[model samples]
Target chain A: MQLSARNQIRGKIKTITLGSIMAEVQVELPDGQQIVSAITRNSVETLQLHENDPVIVIIKSTEVMLGKQA
Target chain B: MQLSARNQIRGKIKTITLGSIMAEVQVELPDGQQIVSAITRNSVETLQLHENDPVIVIIKSTEVMLGKQA
Candidate 1:
């Protein structure tokens, strides 16, 4: 499927922390970098995400902040 | 500074498309993956973001979707 989102990172599920309504997912890239995402618990179940599963992290935000070092 | 956002990718600015209120910034990673971000024009000026600038992309979203191939 085509998405308007421009950032697409391929990573493996490293951990999953479930809450009452939200779930925190940690995705580890091949280069040893980890990306954490907070998603709805229902979407987590719908996606059937689990540890060691290969998945793509799709992020679309209206506020992508830029930071530079001084 | 510390941020609550989980995903942070280091990349260089490749392109910038500015509008009256919002702006589109394209960041290219080392692995050749491009991540696009939409930010307000005020932020663009505040951060002094421009092409070829090295910056970190910070994304915080409540809806980070996961997609798996069948």
Candidate 2:
């Protein structure tokens, strides 16, 4: 399936911290960049995510915001 | 105001394509990577964004997703 999200970076799961209804996943890029994602608990279970698993980070262009230094 | 978004990258606005109620912004990173953002026209006006303006790219963690190769 095709995704409309503009950002799709490849990374490895560094960690997954589960909460009541949410999960925070840390994805480490090959360039050493780190991105934290907070997704639904169900998504984690559905994806069967685990540490060191290769995954694509998905972010929609509409979800992006621009801020100038104040 | 502190934003809950986990990703905030530094870049400069490259272009702005305005529509009836929305606008698409292209930002170029220091490393020449580009990020596209689609936002409300009101937000563009509110922020008064312009080309060549230095900006921060903000994305909420909850808006992030992970996809594994099927």
Candidate 3:
């Protein structure tokens, strides 16, 4: 799917492998970039992600917001 | 200051420059890395970040969780 915003963070599914109770997910970005993140093994089986699947990476500005909330 | 987590994401305040209504936050990382993110100009002024200020980057596994949320 084409993104409306250029810098909007998103990921392309590369592969998923089981690792004990955790799943190692490899997500690719535009220009062949990739990052590996771990998640629940169940989530991986549930999602059933395959090679070349489009996925969104959602991040709230506040989440990245550094500072004490008062 | 020291980080307990080896890969804990954080930023070192490099500089903040005003740009229109936005503030360009230049954050540096270890090994001489950096990423520029834009925030409200007021936030910069409010935070009063100076050189070498430590800032945390919080990201939930669910947020980077690829696939649709159910």
Give the number of the best model, judged by DockQ.
2
Which digits, one per residue and each the tens of the lDDT, describe model 2 over residues B1-70?
Answer: 8877788877899999999899999988665657789999998999899999999889888888899997
- Which rank order by TM-score, best down to worst? 1, 2, 3
Please list all clashing residue pairs in model 3, or write none if there are none.
none
Cα lDDT tens digits, model 3, B1-70, are 5432212355587776787787666666453445455677787778776667887544444434455434
Clashing pairs in 1: none
Worst 10 contiguous positions by lDDT, candidate 3 chain A: A61-70
Residue A39, model 1: lDDT of 84
Candidate 3's error at B46, in angstroms? 12
After superposition, candidate 1 runs with Cα above 4 Å error: B61-63
Give the local distance difference test score of model 2: 0.87
The interface root mean square deviation of candidate 2 comes to: 1.9
Model 1 chain B worst lDDT window (10 residues): B61-70
lDDT per residue, candidate 1, B1-70, as tens digits? 8887777778899998999999989888776767788888888888888899999978774546677776
- The C-alpha interface RMSD of every prediction is 2.0, 1.9, 7.3
RMSD of 2: 2.2
lDDT of 3 by residue, A1-70 (tens): 6432212345677787787798767776554545455678887778876677777654434333444223
